[model samples]
Target: MLPPASQFRAQQKRLDQFEALTGIKTTYSYVPYGQLLDKITTEAVGGSSEYDLFSFQDSWMASLVGYLNPLDASIAADKLDMGRYPEVFREACIVGGKTYGLPIRAHPQLLFYRKDLLGEVGAKVPASWSDMVATAGAIQNKSGISGVALDYVKGSGFQNLWLWFNCLWGHGSDLFDAAGQPRFNDAAGVAGTQAYVDVLLKDKVANPGSSQFNEYDMVNSMAQGKSAMIMVWWWTYSVLTGDRSRLKPEQVGFAPMVRFNGGKSPTLATLMPFGISKQSRHKAAAWEYLKWVSNPDLEVEIVCDKSDPQTSDIVATQTATYLNDKVNAVNHGLHRVALESLKGARILPKLTIWPEVASVLETTISEIVAVGKPVKPSLDDAAAQVARIARRSGRHRS
Candidate 1:
């Protein structure tokens, strides 16, 4: 798990409770995001691992399926309700019709904006991509601040892709087509990419520093009152209105991600699920831990617990938790907004070669956004590279 250390410690505190109830002691390892893929692959290749359970991102699921134990039997025996989570999240935990894990952390993009700034500019919350840009331009002209802040840095795992996914999908384009070939270089994709870059290049409504910004930098721009809006993960509610922010809680507002005109709105969703290691000696105990931690009641308790600063969390994976009355009251109705976003959210292609595909697209997008490269040609080049990767991996379909 990636750190603040405090967040995981809070989870460990709950695991301590699980130990008391089930007599199963638990410990966790924190790996930096960049190192997690290598660590998991190393452990899998070695045929033994120290951890009984593995917590990993959805993108890695296809590659790690062989190393993870299928949980269908356990879920059936326990009558576990996988329906507790949204469909997108549930789909991420399954591979080839087999349940491999349970989702623990999930996030959908939310348009976080300054209510006060929008009101000052007489701009309404944007419901479409064009509306968002117009609102941004209005805010920039009237409020004397960057209308929006976005992540567009060259590296750092291509956080910029998160922002672009909304545009690409909204334009009815996807990373891959029905035949399992790259198609984001198609006409719709080129148009979507053009619109995405226009904010910084043509319209000039984005924060100037965004050319070099990552996710943290974009969020910080909002917290420090340098930008009027940002489309970020739901978990950012705390940071945008917490002690570090320059604005008050009342001044911040949340909305669903914008869509293309007359097109579907699809926010890119993220899932972090825990899978039992196939080689684990205590698969049953690990399953018990998974059940205990994923309980909707426990998720609500964690989100509403303001007593422990380290353990307090706002992200919820279950529908019931998001709709909880008490949870909304505590977290400013963020869960309600999140539920709406997740209903139409999009997950990445379930491919073992996603890391490689992602790297190619990241570099292509970075060059286009940072160095003023042509969009269509760059996307075409990336598509060719991705096709080669798919072919080499023997995962290409037709």
Candidate 2:
């Protein structure tokens, strides 16, 4: 089995538990992020690999479809109900009318604020982007700290585009039209990009060095008391309330991602799916292990484990796990809030060339935010670049 570095420890613990419970032995391998995709591709193409199962990001499904074994037969034989997971997650696992993976971990964006700071300044939690900006400015003036922390840095690929996509969706625009042509250069797109840029360049509520910060940097800023609030993934709650953080659990608050006035609230979902490699010699045994590890009961237990006590990583794909009374009671209704957020959640475009498209978009945003390039021209250039790639790939028309 192969797992990424970020999930290695928890996966190791779960594997040990599985081994002890069933008297089965499973070997493990840890792969770093940059080398994971190449490793999977090379091993699968060679038709001889040592690893039986591997974990991958949702966006990679399209590119890796040829090398993965479809899980629909196994799921059917095992009598697992796909309906138990969210529709968006289920859709991500399916490519070309076949199920290739099972969703194990998912992330949705949330607004993490310092509850004590908001109360001290007499400001309510912001419900819209305009309110967020105004509230951030007020909080900054009243207390001498950066109002917000954002992942505005360049070259982070997709980290920058995640929040931008939320702004676009909130404003009733999308990265592409129904015809599969780029449409983010339209009026709503301009407004979304401008609003995001103004947060750092115009309103100045974020730290001056925000252009260098990614998800980790922004979360660390909030944990160290350097920023009053942040918009990031829900998994970071573990860090803010962990032993090393400066704040206590009671001081932090979570809310749905801010929406446009009278607009539906939407956030991006980061999903990690686990699949069995086609070249594995022990496909049947691997399938059994996958079912055991992804069981809803086991997931709930892992999310609410009392031994560590500081971790708040919620279950990714199962709805019942989040709705469980035991999970909600221990998490202070975090599961409930996450469920609400998922109502308007969306996954990234399932195109094989999404990585290239994301790189172009992130660069354009950097030019606008860091180099003072005008918004409309920058976005138009990005749209053109994406359209070129989409046309070349035969996935979309210009």
Candidate 3:
């Protein structure tokens, strides 16, 4: 399974060619990213006659396990040779003592900055939120563009949704505890976010269009020099810095996401995973394909190997060994520094109503920033709605 038509045809073609040469007939389906997960689940529940394996987000592992083939648990991880991939990436696939899916790819968010703009202002790259503000101001003072952009729109499924959450998360805030309580409604979380919003609406140091830009738009802005610095996942490095015609690769640089004034640098992780349907006639064959596509040789060569023209992304495994220390001499961070942030990174709050809860949070954020409501009251209402959604979702208790 893969993304819908326009974006997925190339992948389909690549797989089809591989199958024909190997004489291995395989079942594959393509759907829009928005509809893909639901279609995958529905096909699973009804029957896998039409589809075999399903692709899903990594964070949905727990949900996928209940329905999909317990692939690795059915087969030992060591037997599958987990050593070659990152350890943490392998661990993510194992749920309830069983392995579900092979990791496809992994790329953590990284900091981005423009050398020419920063040099003219003589201001250093911003790390702390306060510094981000100052840097934006300085950049604007010198360049006439907003300093920073944080997503304050509705719909948490988008990158800015996650970006906004990172702000609170980086400052030691979380949406919920393991007990699934609404901890993010606390004073610091609310107060910290208030400042976050004030920067966008009051200070206006962000792009007028940032509220609408997804992960790609931000990175593209940086490549075009519309914005000085963009905080995005590792893929941006490959995409933005690869072409000299667009922006010289040397003009861009990366660093770990910065620290808050009183906070340590946040290392954060989120997931995008895949799982098979409970209703697949081709579960075994699909698993076979997944194994091949996700094998270290393929993933590393296509994704992490910068020197290779096919190199596209970082490895999905969490282990440090998976990283290439000096691919084309890129300043790849070898440290497990992000491990702490991943540990601290908040997972989506437990709610079967996640789709709805995400919508409410996004709308509430839009109102706070777009409508100019008092940040705290808007948060209180959002927390209330989220609690209500939790009760409705039936996954969270008390």
Give the candidate number with the greatest TM-score.
Answer: 1
User: What would the TM-scores of all predictions be?
Assistant: 0.96, 0.94, 0.82
Q: lDDT per residue, candidate 1, 218-288, as tens digits?
A: 99998999999998888888898889899899999999877775536677899888899988898889989
Residue 110 alpha-carbon offset, candidate 1, angstroms: 0.3
lDDT of 2: 0.82
Q: Output the worst ten-in-a-row residue range by lDDT, candidate 1.
A: 1-10
Q: Model 1: what TM-score?
A: 0.96
Best-to-worst ranking by lDDT? 1, 2, 3
Residue lDDT tens for model 3, 62-81: 55566777776534643677
How well is each residue in 303-328 modelled by candidate 2, as lDDT tens digits?
A: 77756543325555689977889988
Query: Where does candidate 1 stray beyond 4 Å?
Result: 1-7, 261-263
Residue 85 of model 2 has an lDDT of 89
Q: List the global CA lDDT of all models.
A: 0.86, 0.82, 0.62
C-alpha lDDT of residue 384 in model 3: 87
State in Å the error of residue 306, model 2.
3.3
At residue 204, candidate 1 shows an lDDT of 94
